[model samples]
Target: MQGIIHLWSLDATEPHELTTETLGQAQILGCGSVLHLLRTLSWVRTKQNRIAESSTKLWLVSRNAVGLERMQAQSPDSSRQDSSTRDSLAIAQAPLWGLGKVIALEHAELWGGMIDNPEVADVLVEIGAAIVSGEKEDQVAYRDGQRYVARLVKSDPLAFDGTSLSTENSYLITGGLGTLGLKVARWMIDQGVRYLVLTGRGVPSIEAQRRLDQLEEAGATIMVANADVSDGARMTRLFQEIEEKMPSLRGVIHAAGVLDKEILTKQDWGRFRRAIAAKVEGSWHLHTLTRAMPLDFFVCFSSTASLLGGLRLGSDAAAFMDTLAHLRHFMGLPGSSIDWTMWADDGMSLPSQEDGKFEDNDWGGSDKLAEYTMAPGIGLRILGTLMRKADTAADAVQVVVLPKDLSYLQGFYGDRIPPPLLSELYRSESVQPSGSSDFMEELEKIPVEKKRDHLATHIQSQLNRVLGFAPSQTMDLQKGFFDLGMDSLMAVEIKNRLQTSLGCKLPTTLAFKYSTPSLLIDYIATQILALESPEGIVTESKRAANEPEEILNKVKRLSEEDLEALIDEKVRF
Candidate 1:
């Protein structure tokens, strides 16, 4: 690029084309650019920085006229590195996790989907600063056999300078390739971490490679290994391998977890006990494995289940929760003889089929449940803060993260779910179904035919029963959608049963609403016809509302995606 290109003025009707001499004529727009910069920053990073007691999102962007004009007058190539931060004091913190908004200089909404991973957050911050100073950043590499190109857009100074944390030593992630694991993996890079050891199950995909590339380009070298943290022998072997490759290891991030669908009665006694094995027992494995190794902090991702004494459905996990509570009580553990950890779930609330169920602004009368759900989350957070300061606390530090309503309570925290705010989808009603239906009963009704017409008739019958209306071969779609009250939750349930009985890939939304049996049957017929091999619906796990096999598979696959993807992969059975 020859000399330079500049044109901007919020006060003018059109962008002002200013040269070095006339640039001074431009009017200063108090917070226009500031707000825009903050929004953009939320898209890529979130500032953990605080100013005068406000947690703001920060970005380092190109300098402004006030600073740039002053610098150029001194030197032609003159520019200054700047810090940009936004305080999202008002927006729902949980939803806008990594975004900031500019209403007044008071606060910003840290976009949630964006900064789920710390690495992405860190890089965005650095980029924001570079842009503010009018400097070009080096090419950042990306995965998927390509590179992600980023540019420095012109912007003014941010009110608060972002904080810089030291990332000198190597870190170990127990569930290194799990959902949170992958995200935290790259986040380490953003904070100036140098090397990474990725441990998880499965072969790396294009996106996974791209992440490694991006992190590496951002100066974070990564290594990939597939191992189950629950297997101490394999874990020991992995550490030995890591020792041979990249020796400097300092921290451990334990974000692995196991979720159950029913109360203890619903599952085999031994089968349900595995939750403890994977979560709590796994933590012990990591603690003992690296006990003598040189390490700093051990961050374990405990669930809100422990704090809430576990839930009705997940109460069996109490033993695991107890393990965390007694991590310090257990001996032979490394780093102060106990694990310093962070217990995290979604937020103060739990993500359920009901999180989005409030039809009226009065919060839909679920405040009590929401309060109960969020309590453990707050406790987890407090524990985390204490755990980080473990040396000053009792023996170890512990923090917690609970779930919250993105649509309602994100403002209370410092995160936003990001828009396209709430997936403004206009789905066909034939796709929607009742979410909380009896799972086994639905499967029992499937006809013993291996064709679309058979499945179509089956759906027609079910629709007639549910809505108390029969239909012809074809019916109006609105009958299934609007009048019937179908939603995302119902859609999931319907689809699961449909796939099992119909032996086809049913649109997940079909169960939400069919207005009329006729319309829903029409949709099922189409999908049934596409099946390669439709099987008779013989659902298992009768005692428990176990996750649909397909859904579980999807979850397993999701544990391999990036951090943000991990956050998005969240679902409550």
Candidate 2:
């Protein structure tokens, strides 16, 4: 009744009641189902906490390849549920490693690891022996014999061959009404794709319709389908309709997805479900329906968030795409998950400026690093290149297109960046400031009173570069940042510049707190003077050492009335 159940032997007997003793005795608890895996993992975590000395191994064996590396490296076009569900499940599984690590650290006798084996029963004994003997070195083990490792290798720029695409072949593009989708559609037409089926949940916007009309006028047939990709039945029917009308469904660009900005803690199940439906469920539906069809390419439009996990960003959505990539590899499908960085014109790249132009939000506002924003043309070209390479590169499941310039990322990642990436980053020429270190030193050496004006000028110059403003564009010193056309993105860039140049740990809200250029300049000067001044009343160095203790002792000795008067004087300063 306490023995482990083989996945294939689910119907062999009635469900056995598992006790803590039984669970502890069992070296490996294998679960084929993700649900069962999660349940077992939770139970193990509880048991580990409850019984400090318990050693248990939870083996999560799946027929499909599932891991961070597999998910990150491969592009897969599985059922939409597979992508979203698997991704959510994968993320949910991440805590198991943490639990295992903690258990290992706290109790040397405790051992646990996740193993991915298609035939769980075949390796159950071997895995169990390994677990019992404490032979496994890593927390996660793969039974498939394939290793997933990321290597930074320079990909040669691909030439755009217009002759490759055929007019008789039709291509399906989900989210075609959106800016990026529309751009891709237009680019496809230019590349000799005469028939294009663009699908979205609603009617195209007036602007999108106008663009579609222009494409139609250019002699390309554009069919806009008002259908949701998450609806499997609707997708099936839509594909049937396309098969009937179109000459041939040659390719598909799965670009449909919803952007949910809520952080994981703030996000509800509904929000996560809705955000993932378009990318995960939709892609799954497309893959299921189009598996029989002979297609040249099937591209999943994924974001770099899949790897980076941006602040309050789409972690769930990224995981779905990563899982989709792994699923595609498992299925031996012809597709690549392009983990793309930010694009300047479309998507959630940057907020639009007052003149309707998009500002660069790359490098998180640091000019010291290389900008990572890709133009629409450049993005399209990369996509084209990836599609062409997909045929020859069977092992290449994931294609990450990063900015050639990566010096800026060093500021954020520092030594944590992988050596492979570092090698590639140093291989290319990085952007350097025109201003010399000697010039900056000379500016810093100016009289404290004069330093404020010099710092303001320097700050203004840096702001102008980021905002794409000319040297002659005079900024109002009294105006707030918002009034001066400075947004959150711009504010961040300004803060980064100040932190880097002045060597001060400025607050993220520095721009908003100061409000104006003159105020910010004054604040910076005060901080710089406090840092540099040796004879100042309350220098940072003194404050760090014994100022707090001294202040507390002085406060304790003062009377109520005297304390109030002392606080007033301190506030005045």
Candidate 3:
């Protein structure tokens, strides 16, 4: 009855049969309590790591409702109190759905997913089949009697109808003094939000104070509260004070969250818990405190980590935001969670030169801003549209914008890149070539000595194309591919291209093995010549025919006068 009862290790040398007792308990528990779910997860992971089996493995957890009327209809004997409890339970279980995504990434070979479905039977069958079939996707949703898989798609700019906020209503923005929060406060003031309550845990920096003053000058009342949102009693008192002092709290933007530099492997429970507390616990407190109040909208600012699971330890924050969105929907509240990408301005923007915390060439520095970053103006417009459309949108959760080019992200995600993003990434004009053709005919027309130069140029051009380098930019022939920012995915892509164009079956490690344009050119030229010989044979010896190492060794053994003479002859040629 406790501590992983009836659990069969997945790592067993022989497949273990499910017992009647285990099946009975599984049916009775259904998805089980959160603690039971976590225990199951731990066991499955241990098995997956130990066995390394190819058979499909899955973990299914469901909580979100399909339809309020449909759920009520199906359970006619259930009372209103029962429905309310179920709704709350659904919200509590939402975080696990997010954690499921992390698990899928960590154990991609297992065909894992965390699903949110109303029909438990259908989810179980689908997940079981997926595990057996080795399905690739990780996140799934079952709503309105239909199964939906997550995909990334290009987000068009929101068409603004000039929607404006009321002057009488006050908007509470947690983390208001932070870079993103300050931008939201300014946008709200510009959009006719007359009263603003900006909450953070610290006093404003000198620059932040000046901005607050500017907002006041623009005919807005700004109140800065130094309070921690995770503290329930403190938040309760703060809300009570706001209710008494300001106009009714018409909206709440739960944007307060901390981002740590550590990855999941390096993060202990304390660090992980703190990373999520502001967004997870803080949002929960804000929701409970404001549940009774009639509000226009409650927006949770989330990140793409929940969907993609590559933001180091940011997955914890994503899980809570995802849960909060579900909780709001279950309660029939007007709420939306917007999963955002990196912004060019204000929010998660590159640190300024004055800050001096990061060097210019750092990953989060200005150089990266030019590639696939969203402008703050565009991001704010989209936010406003999402807030306005939250009530009418089909799903309570949405992703506002994604990087137009995913080359940078592809390095980290590889083929596991979400299906939704694949269409957009492939559709981009830069990633696709205008045409393709076999270059065998062209290579045959060239003379032997010049063949190496031709192939080298071809390789360089292809490298430039895949890496998004401009036509005018040139690479050093001797540099390593990784030093040129070529990741594993990109290396594979280049290898595939060479194989197709040259009409030869190249090894998957071609790019990594040769590592430089000059070296790859020599290897290809040698192989082609050997294949074109009278014997018509191709082998490793053919590829190493140039023997640059032997030539270098001979040069090292020669006298200085003889080496200079040989170099002069080669240079002349």
Candidate 4:
């Protein structure tokens, strides 16, 4: 505590002895500052020859750096407070939390944690105690002397409780020519939105135009307007045009965004501005333009990058975080910012699984450690469900879809115990064991000739699950994985499933290489049987002819009630 170096006052020229602790305050400067500060600290430590061995921890303190649940509503003087003004100020600091998460992942040793003071109440003493006691929470906030931590909880699907989209009214979708925008457009039409205004900066692509024609043929009115949402004058004119030609605008989906991938050191202000313009400035224009309209929902499509930071995504994090603040604080309408994970199984282009599939760089240089990416069908269902719960959007402003597996997270965090934010997810995955090892053991007991059939059955079951097919449905064994509607992400998922069950290092191109169920089963069975003997022979003791009945009898001993639960637990048919 004696030599605590304050980040603001630290003299870089005259090097002081590195201490065990350092304190810094987060500024409203662009998210690049996060990288800048950490880089500077690391440089200083390296110069002192203590970068690798030092136990020094850097803690960042900020006022309203992140939003705490009910922090404002729970305040004593909430009624008189100007919530919008406070939230706008909070928006500037929101990027710190997003970028700070990346710093934690990339520079874990030097990272202490981030603390947000949401209220005027002094928590300096509490902050010191938390740091001095080696508190594990990396993201914490204080309000009215009460401490709060960020947590990710499983979101059970909410029932549709609001009115359906009116066919007579108009819905506006920004960035409507893009993949996500077009997907949402189709979903809106499915929900009975007959009149839609789809706006984008450039003319639609051939595929985009084809989809537009399909929507038009389906008894819906489609207006494809070429206008940049970030341009204030253009946006105003677009709104005027919409009002003049279409039905009254009742809903808006601000899916407009620009993604530029670069590390912070290589990032320029122009790149940051271009990325932020579509999401931040564009959303602001939409809010100001339609603040008084009777809009049912104003949904901002955000990425998981903002909630759980990614490498080379600092600008995206800043843009999405600011947009979230704009929706929650600035927009009084029914607005929600859903931070969605990678959308797969649609037409989104991904790295080829043919070679170097599991390499870190293969994932577009992203730190997205996810078990399951969102499929368009599932994502659209979630979006539809959220539309009905518009009233709760203000309270639960940010809805982030978390990774399903803790083990995938371990690959990034490099620890058995996850950080505080992911602790809940870790505990959930821990309690509900996947039972993959048990399946493998059962698989090894099968006769060599029958192992191929069993493996095929297992692979079929997984394919069914991924494609959302009924358990009884069977896919063509001769068709390729992609031909059977499997995308790149789905291929990765199948590979992970196989590796876990077989307990071997399967290639990332497992699905693609095998290409079909028949080939896939043959390869997997050969690999497993080869481990037993060169001739692919299993021990007679392990392969009993009555193995199936033995398993049935083992199950029959349980009560009928317990038998039903067993069936529910088994993922295989």
Candidate 5:
């Protein structure tokens, strides 16, 4: 069954399982569902940039006439490059995946607005029915055999006369509706995102739906996606659905996890398996799914238990989990340093009470159980990293999350690699030197002449701020007032500053070579020149390459100028 359960997903779509019910898509003659349609549809828009390979222009805000005009105007290729742009007349816009939760939604009903070209607008308006339904009939056939139904639910930025994008972005809460999960979801909604997806082990109850209803009325696009994170197949399937259904997925914060703590000598074997499934294997599965995507970011929630490799799960559990976390980091799960997974006490699982005061655990004075378990900031930081690491709206980087700050609740579990391994992280790969040797110190003293050559630049820090220039740009400064025009003065000032700073009055022509600050810095450091020195042996030593055969060979080599010329054939650059 373990093999059979490798993959499974609730979001999996089958032809037989249609939407059957239009939850909120078409309510009360198109007004109620407009916001539902666009705000819940997930997608990512990519625009190739002449400058950056990953740059993309997302159609996130252009629902109003003026906004649409600007979006179209600024587009790199918005001309008649393709008639389909206008020919389509209507587009079935999906939900912007990363949009968090909508804070507001407003509409305009039939109050005619001005269009730059009234004739073109009239033509588009005249064919609206055909564009929405008549043409889409061949594609989006319904149970009743209808075409793409008449639905116009697009969101634009604030101040535009169309649907407004919540001031923030999109957010996904994998364990939405749970104690910690629900709180996190609500927090995101309050942050002004346009959409929120909630996933859990089960369907959200009526109470959860009521909360969502209130949130929706307040202008939030909310959804419920359920799956147990430990289920590898289900998780993989969920990721695929996100690609097809909600392409705008920025990143996932794996807040859904399980825990089992008992003495190693006393805990059952099944306890160990379940814990591994939740803490380690689940992390691996999420890590794998994220790797297959060009994601914004990904973070695995780890416990402080894994950090200390605490004895509760004993040495084996600690070693496995710590190694797993390190592997996760190696796979590019975000951060330059190994992040420690810490937690708050409230999120930890405990026994439910039976009509009585909460029974205290053995070693408790205060309620340290949750502080010992809830992964603090792991969820939020993963979310933050994904949102932050989004290189372009089109390409998102993945990250890992560990709770270090919440260690008061409980300490970590793992074989803490000693500082000895840390010290040798970047050691020499060639020769094995003495244990006490400082190879780095010896390497650093190789002398400037042996260093690599590089581009040099010079910058003049102005007495007055450069006003509009950034720190990396050059600033020209001259003594008193210059008799020359701006361009000439700049060149002269640059030359003098380089001379003063370097203490070597270089050729005026060299000023052109080191015009940039970065170039000037390179000029200062990367200086190289090779000088041929005689190779000789020192002192009385008994070693090979020193015996009579070697000495005689060296003497012969010195006499042979032809041998020297033969060796000079190679150039290293």
Candidate 6:
């Protein structure tokens, strides 16, 4: 079979057959099962060679995993502009969608697709047709018995007439001492907001204090509360203080989050919990505390990692905020979640040079696709747009806000083509260049003595592109990759670039094992020599002797199913 479908259910005892009624409204839950399944799938891909073959596709099915506009039968003379276009969102499954995006990027060959069913209609038939249709649309959601595909369309900031912040009402901003918080505070002041309550885990730094003072000087009454949003007692106390001293809470901006970056193999529960502490738990506290209040708007600042997974950003956990926003809207509350790309001035999200300014290159070579970093001015304008639309557009609670053209992001994927989800935003129809064959032919034309040098130069050029080094600058062949400030994402990029160029199946931990350019050169040279060997005789002998550790690594990375498969094969033999 070309495809294998795996169905995930909350109640495992339930039969695998489809049902007529919807399962239930989406909820905000933990990620224990989600993480387990992701870990298993990751291992399966790494260990099972057949599963990773180009012809085989792996599909994951989830219920109520995505939030989409519910379809209504169009009337002849009436327009459908109802506020209840969405029923509920499965916030608990946000991690699956977030991580799935990353998987689609990292393993496009084995990726079948992600299908979210509402369970209200012929779920089996819809899923079967989706898989067999040979379409590039990987992210699909069914709502009200209608099929809907996700799209990342461009929205103009000017299209939204900005909302006015009342001078008499108080607004609470979590993580208010950080860069984004202060920027929003400044914007609020500009919008004529007079009362502001800003909360953070600790006392503000000198810079934060300076910004706070600036806001106070602008004729706004500001309250700086040292409280962690994740702590229920602390959040309650802060709300009490606001009740006693400040004006009635009119709005809330949930901007609290912590960044945790690691691959699945390296991730632990502690890291995952830290990543979701402020994003999920803190948002929950805010939701429960303010559910009774008649707020004008409730905004949550989410990352693009939730929508389009970032490399090693723990995007799965980060996606909970999106679901939380949807949950609020489902309850008829004024809620909106803004999935923001990296901010130009936000140091917490983007790595910067010692001078505090971004490098001349795009995103300092960490992410070539981040040319659309949201500037403070533009981001706040989008926030204003969201605030204005929160009441009228309840179904638009989850908004993926990115400015300008997004076609260049296609380069970020392994296929060098934008996923169907981004078709509306990315209109690039350029032909994909096939360079691996030409590269191999050039390698064959090179003399045997100069092959190593040629490969070295090519590897160095790719490394230079990743590291943002000038083309003329030479990287030390003996120096370690990590020592040159290369991160895990950079390592993955280098490995992917080489794998694509060389047309070889390199290990996922390629840079980690090789460590240095000189060492990597030797290993790659051997692979090239083996590929060019006569009758595949030298390839077999050299592979066994020179790459025993690779075999051992594969064995070490085996999953439970892999071990079971091995036992079955041994019994058959």
- TM-score for each model: 0.36, 0.54, 0.60, 0.61, 0.34, 0.74
What is candidate 4's local distance difference test score?
0.59
Better of 3 and 5 by TM-score: 3
Best model number under lDDT = 6
Per-residue CA lDDT of candidate 5, range 332-379, in tens? 453111123333444222110111122232212133233334354444
CA lDDT of each prediction against the hidden true structure:
0.37, 0.54, 0.58, 0.59, 0.33, 0.65
Global fold similarity of model 6 (TM-score): 0.74
Candidate 6: segments with Cα more than 4 A from true spot: 1-9, 12-30, 44-58, 70-88, 118-133, 154-162, 311-314, 346-370, 414-416, 427-450, 467-469, 472-524, 528-573
TM-score of 5: 0.34
Off by over 4 Å in 5: 1-172, 205-218, 311-573
Writing each residue's lDDT as its tens digit, candidate 2 over 327-419 gives: 555555666677777676442341111111222332223332226567777888778876775544644456666777666554332222222
| Cα lDDT of model 3 by residue, 1-573, tens digit | 112211122111210232323322322233223324544544564455432332445555554522232122223333333354334444434445444454444444343455555365765565655546745544555554555555555545667776557899898998888777888899998888999998878888787888899999999988888888877888989998898899999888887776554333334455655665677667778877887887777888877666655324355456556556655666677677777776665325311111112222223234434564688888788778767766555453454456655666543343233433254344322322223445667867776555566677787887776565653357898976655655344555676667667765555345645678777776677654342322333444465786888788887899999989988999999
Q: lDDT by residue for model 1 over 1-573, one digit each (tens)? A: 111111123232221232212212221121233334443433333243211222243331111111111011112332332222111111111101111111111122221112211244445554465446633222222222222322212232222222122465566765555434555566566656787777665555565566667777888767777776666678879888888888577667665555433222123435543444454345556766666765555555544332222222122232233333233323323222111122233321221111112222111123323433434334333333433443333334333332332232222111212122112211122322333335335544554343445555566544332222343333344453323432222233344445544444443224422335555665445433432233332332332345677667776665455645667667431
Better lDDT candidate (2, 4): 4
Q: By how many angstroms RMSD does model 1 differ from the true structure?
A: 27.9
Q: What clash count does candidate 1 reach?
A: 76
How do all the candidates rank in terms of TM-score, highest first? 6, 4, 3, 2, 1, 5
Best by TM-score: 6
* Candidate 4 lDDT over residue span 224-275, tens digit each: 8988887888999999999899999988877776554444333455665555
What lDDT would candidate 3 get against the real structure?
0.58
How many residue pairs collide in each prediction?
Answer: 76, 12, 4, 0, 54, 0
- Evaluation by TM-score, superior candidate among 3 and 4: 4
